[model samples]
Target: MMDANVSDQRLRHQHQGLWLVAGIAGVLLLAAASIAIGAEDLSPGQAWDAVTAFDPADNRHLLVRHLRIPRALAALLVGAALGAAGVVMQALTRNPLADPGLLGVNAGAAAGIAIAIAFFGQAEAGAYVWFGLGGAALSGLAVYLLGGVRQGMNPVRVVLAGSALTVMFLALTHMVTINSEAEVFDQFRHWTVGSLEGRGFAALGAVALPIGAGLLIVAGLARRLDAVALGDDLARSLGSHPGRTWALAAFAVILLAGAATAAAGPITFLGLTAPHAARAIVGTAHRRLLPGAMLLSAGTMIVADMAGRMVARPGEVGVGIMIALIGGPFFIALVRGRRLGHS
Candidate 1:
């Protein structure tokens, strides 16, 4: 019996490892495409030469070195951040539809960034990440209080509270932007629409720590979440603290979402869709699910960003718009499928 169990565990790891490899491969391929295909297309050889073989005179080399690489990294990091956050949130709520946005985390982060720009004139990402994290924490706390933890945490009430808060925070963001200087509006507008136009390594570096910390927290919470998903009573009986799990998971989500929003604004649907797709590949186990979703989302974001460049040509569509165009249909289909399944 012991030998059989060990064999089963090994097999599971091997299977999950394969999916992880596939995810990595997909992201790498798309990232390469992201660097190579753009406003001015560059061959893979040229892309490499741009890095290895220097030519300051070549505009393509400068574009590759300065623009494409940074944008791709930003998209990849933000996508992975949101994807990981989404997985943690869905597990906590036991609701497949639960995303960081459903809890107003993204809106709060955006509001924070807007406030920073409007009030403090701090427009850099370093300031954005901090203000964003602060805003997210406040919004999450509001939801927690309104969510009725004293009576036991109800996922439905929490979601509703989040929905209400999201509206309020979004309005607050707009009010600040509208009331501020026209320059603020111009800057905020670009970010709000979610573009990757001129972001560089500085932007990525600003959010990396928070995002990394969030990923670490999510990883620690995965097994505990597995226990919690079985129900609070069952989780406690198994020696997991469901309350602690919720607190930590919520913190992790806020961290991830805030940092991502700080980097690329409030991107929707990637979070909601990535987990479901990962589940199909890795089943319900979060250890596999988190990485799978992260890779899938990272690849998807790179693809959406590249496609945005292609569709608009001289003028490009925002990555946010491209994502919505893809994810909106997927969301509709998911809802329809759920309804049909229930019926």
Candidate 2:
């Protein structure tokens, strides 16, 4: 019996390894497709050459090099960041349905961006990144403090606090939007839609540090997160510091989700859907789960972005709109089908 159990475990591990490799391959393929399938069609060879070589005289090469490449990279990086942050937030709260956006992280970031544009008249992407990060960090701290988890942190309380805060920020955002000048509102509308258009490598460069640091922190904590899944007291007994682990996870979420939102505005449901889909395919072990979630998210976003560009026939549907269209039903189903705490 012992030998049989060991063999079964090994087989499961092998299967998981296969899934991870396959997922990563799919993401790469989707990214390549995204680059090739934009408005101006380019053969794979041309696109490859365009990306590699520089010719100021060649408009096609310049477009591919300066536009599509950076846009594709932004989609991949933002999707990966949101996916990884979603997994961390879900694990930290022990709630399968938890999403970074739903927990006020995105709202806080959006609010910050809106305020910056309305007051400062500065709507630049680089400046928005800092504002968004600051807002998200402050909101997350507020949620944690108000959630009232004295004996031990309760997922429900934290989620509730986050939800309330989200509602408040969203209301404030709308108020500001409504009262702002037409020109400011016009600019705000574009920023809110979440497009990958016209972005350069510099936008990706801005997020590299925070996203890289967050991913490293998450990777190192994979084992600890697994222990956390065993319950707080048990995790502590096993020599893991639950409080410190939770704080680190929260910080990771802020850095990742904030930067992504700042880069692409608010993308609805990628975080919620991606991690849950990954968990459904692979069981709830953090080590396997995080990578699967990241790949799935990256692939999903790339596909959605490609579809949006194609479906609109010259005009493109913004990524935010596409995600919302797909994510709305999924979110409802997840909420309706299960008891609140089961996740």
Candidate 3:
């Protein structure tokens, strides 16, 4: 019995270490690929030279420095933010299907971008950050309030409230785009599809602090989240305030998911799939799950972005569409396979 227990512990530790290593390696590989491979292919040597010795005279070097670097970095940070938000959201809602988009964060951000384009004449995504944040915050608040912010909230009600709000916001976004000018509609349409094409360091910088702060807050609340994963009464008995913990986690989710969506135009399925994949690899422990999901999501985003670059050659598919193509099926499989009502 003792030997069996010892062996199991050793295997668990080995698995944990392997997962961490694999996650790191996957992220590094994807990052390299994202930077190296684009519309214009360059040799490994050229890519390295571009990174090491940037020269304005060299188009390859300029592409790497001015475009790929920022894009790759944006994908990484945005993926991380969304992954962390997903983990917290699932924990808070006690629903496996719960993602950042469940509370209309994506729609809210889209609506904000539409408003910015139509009303404020803001053409750039970086300029939409503030409006997106405001919209996300307000929409999230609306969902929470409508879902019963009072004590002993029901997860089902929250989900229903979010679904309704998502529809409403999406409708509003559609109406705004339809009535807006052709130029504004074109820009908004592309932005809503979610692409890393034109995004740069400035776009990433706009949301970096918020995402970072949200990650820190979520990290601190991991244990509490675990407690909340149990029944609310049990969590309270274990000295975790379920309501407070959920509220904090929800706020963090808004910050992280909102920033990611605002920065990159709502990359879906990453938040939904990343946490579940992390749970499969690292088990339910948020300590490992959070970072694991972050790495996985970052890699997934990079892969999707790379695929978008390759599939159409010069034309390129949007990362959002690529993810939808991948995630829509995964979502269906999950629904068909799992019992999501009582996660």
Candidate 4:
């Protein structure tokens, strides 16, 4: 019986390993498609040569090398960040429906961007990203305090707090930008809609550190998240600090979701959906669930980005709009179901 049980465990691990590899390959394929299928769509050969050969003499090659590749990479990073953050949020809250956005991070980040563009006269993403990150971190901190996660987590209270904060931040953002110049609002407009249209490698590099740190934090906190999911009392008995975990997870979410929002404007629904979907596939193990969610979310982002490029033909739609359209129905269905009531 012991031998049989060990064999079964090994078999499950092997199967999961295979699934992880397949998931990675799938994301890579989607990313390749994203690079090749933008507004100035490239042939697969051209795409390959753009990366490998890099004929600067060819305008198309320059477009692919400088423009498409950076945008695709940015999408991948943003998606992975949102996905991992979502898993951490849901696990920390014991709510499968819990999204990082529910912490009001998006609103805070948007508000920051608006202020930067309007009051500070910052136009570039790199310039405003710090303001965005600051806002997102503060928002997450406020939510953590208001939700009383350290005292005791109540999903209803946390969601309510997040909702209230979101409204407040959004209203303030509008007020801040109401009298700004046309150009300022124009920049804010494009950002609020969440486009990958013009993001260059610099923006991608700027966000990589925070997102990478956030991922590392989440990856390290996996077992702690699991213990917290079993409830604070049990987690304490198991030698885990539930309160500390809550704080760390919130910070991690701020880092991940904030940097993601910094990179791409608040792309909704990806953060909410990825973890829930990953849970269905990977069970409740935080270790497995976190990475699984990241990969799936990365693939989703690439596909959404590619679809955004195609949906308007010569013109392009923003990735944010595409994600909302795709994830909106799923969100509705999840809400209609019993998941929200309990978690």
What is candidate 2's CA lDDT for residue 100?
A: 82
Worst 10 contiguous positions by lDDT, candidate 2: 334-343
- What lDDT tens digits, residue by residue, belong to model 4 across residues 202-313? 7888788999999999999999988998888899999998778877888899999988997789898998888777766676688888889999899888888899889898
TM-score, structure 4 vs. true: 0.92
Candidate 3, 225-309: lDDT as tens digits? 8899887989999999888887888789889998899988888788988888777678788888889889988888888899999
Weakest 10 consecutive residues, lDDT, candidate 4? Answer: 334-343
**Over 4 Å off in model 2, which ranges?**
148-152, 328-343
* Candidate 1 residue spans exceeding 4 A from truth: 1-13, 122-129, 148-152, 335-343
TM-score of each: 0.90, 0.92, 0.94, 0.92
Model 4 has a clash total of: 0
Which candidate comes out best when scored by TM-score?
3
Backbone clash pairs for candidate 2 read: 96-343
RMSD of each: 3.0, 2.4, 1.9, 2.4
TM-score of structure candidate 2: 0.92
